[model samples]
Target: MVEGRPVGRVGDVDWLLTGSGDPVTVFAHGFGGGISDTRPLGSGVDGTRVFLSFRGHGGSGPLPPDWTYDTLADDVRQVADLHGATRAVGASLGAGALTRLVADEPERFERLVLFLPAVLDEPRPAEARGRFVALADALDADDEDRLASVVALEVPAEFSGSAAARTYVRQRTVALRAPGMREALRRLPALTAVPSADALRALRAPTSVIGCVGDPLHPASVAEALADAVPNAILHVYPQPGVLWNQRGDLRRRISEFLNSR
Candidate 1:
């Protein structure tokens, strides 16, 4: 059974746990996502899988007034330490947080799996950032129409064609209509300072990256760049468009193979 509780005051971060073993695998979801986003990953993996909701997302409390990658990483470490995590898998912003955690405390995580991580040398396109910011502002203003527009813009192009995507967007929009969402998005700018290519390359733990060919948020070239930088890092490219969050089977196969190899 998955247990939910508070690991720290930033918010009541719930830890979802399954299985029993030494090498606990912790699941970290992306921006605007929660522990439920990791349900597929947990189902795919065989051992202990712990899913955490980042500060301001899901059941976690609002993000600290001042948030940074270090703070996010520290939160992850605290939860991992509490659960004795031996391995970790993170997607997008979560991947950024895990990277910093492994770098700061190498002994804590035995292996790392990063999915469609967001690390761009240049700032995100002004138009895209503006759209997200506008949505956040609208949410703060309690403007439902503007908030829905923002959700539409945030949805990946690939998801546009799927019924699941439509349902997800509606559900997420409703969830974000609450008061704390704007504050959460306000804290997102801090996530822009992702680890440099050299820093990711220097990581000591065995690493693997999963890339989707057409995710605007996390371009495939970024994965290629990291694979080039890190020694022995495995890169798996999927033909599917958008992020790997929706591609459970492919991601599971690649991650399982990589972890077992180590």
Candidate 2:
């Protein structure tokens, strides 16, 4: 559907394209994020931006029963091939997939930026899994208040006290109302566990990591572990999620500088 390359089904997943230039960059969104979540990072970049909505996210199709990090990474690889993207950035679960992709096919990407990776060292707790299940239940029932309540529990203590943060959580949670969103949330924990830290040490691409404070689900330690494991990796830790909107400029500068340096 776009000018440069064929835009349609890649295996079973669908991708939306944006921007136009050389040396394409792909922006992969977090667990709850869709194409819109990628807009801020992709907008000012000086190249084509491919925003991939993973299976069951945004406009993409439902996830297969066997879906895992490898499946998601392969989907990203398909998009990278379609657009010839050598530089890419991803957040949370999206970042986990990108890490897996680079580990599997290092030649596919020249550089990468990982933000708030959800991949953790320990197995996901039953409490957290229960929270996601409850979120899906609330979403299935279309109970906005219940959905917000479940999400609020995960918000960092600092952000929970602020009105803007609550509003932002509500706004972000609305995306779960989309068709197939429940499947994505329910499967997220398993996906996060794959492409383990030991597996990521093999990645060769230069990478930069961004960590946010006060988010229990995406702790700063995960980012630190990744930066230490991957070759040629750097990290920047932000204060909290509430400042992310105003901090886009800093994020953009760092990602661009890192990608351009190589």
Q: What lDDT tens digits, residue by residue, belong to model 2 across residues 135-246?
A: 9899888888889888777555566768877776876787677666787678766555443577666677788998987666677777888898888888898987633555
Which regions of candidate 2 fall more than 4 Å away from where they truly are?
A: 1-9, 125-130, 140-142, 152-171, 193-195
Q: Each model's TM-score? A: 0.83, 0.84
In angstroms, how far off is 80's CA in candidate 2? 0.7
lDDT of each: 0.69, 0.75
Best by lDDT: 2
As a whole number from 0 to 100, the lDDT of residue 225 in candidate 1 is: 72
lDDT of 1 by residue, 140-221 (tens): 7878777777777556665674787677777778767655667766656545434565665556777888787755667777
In candidate 2, what residue range of length 10 has the lowest lDDT sum? 1-10
Error of 2 at 156 (Å): 7.1
Pairs of colliding residues, candidate 1: 11-61
The deviation in Å at residue 182 for candidate 2 is 2.6
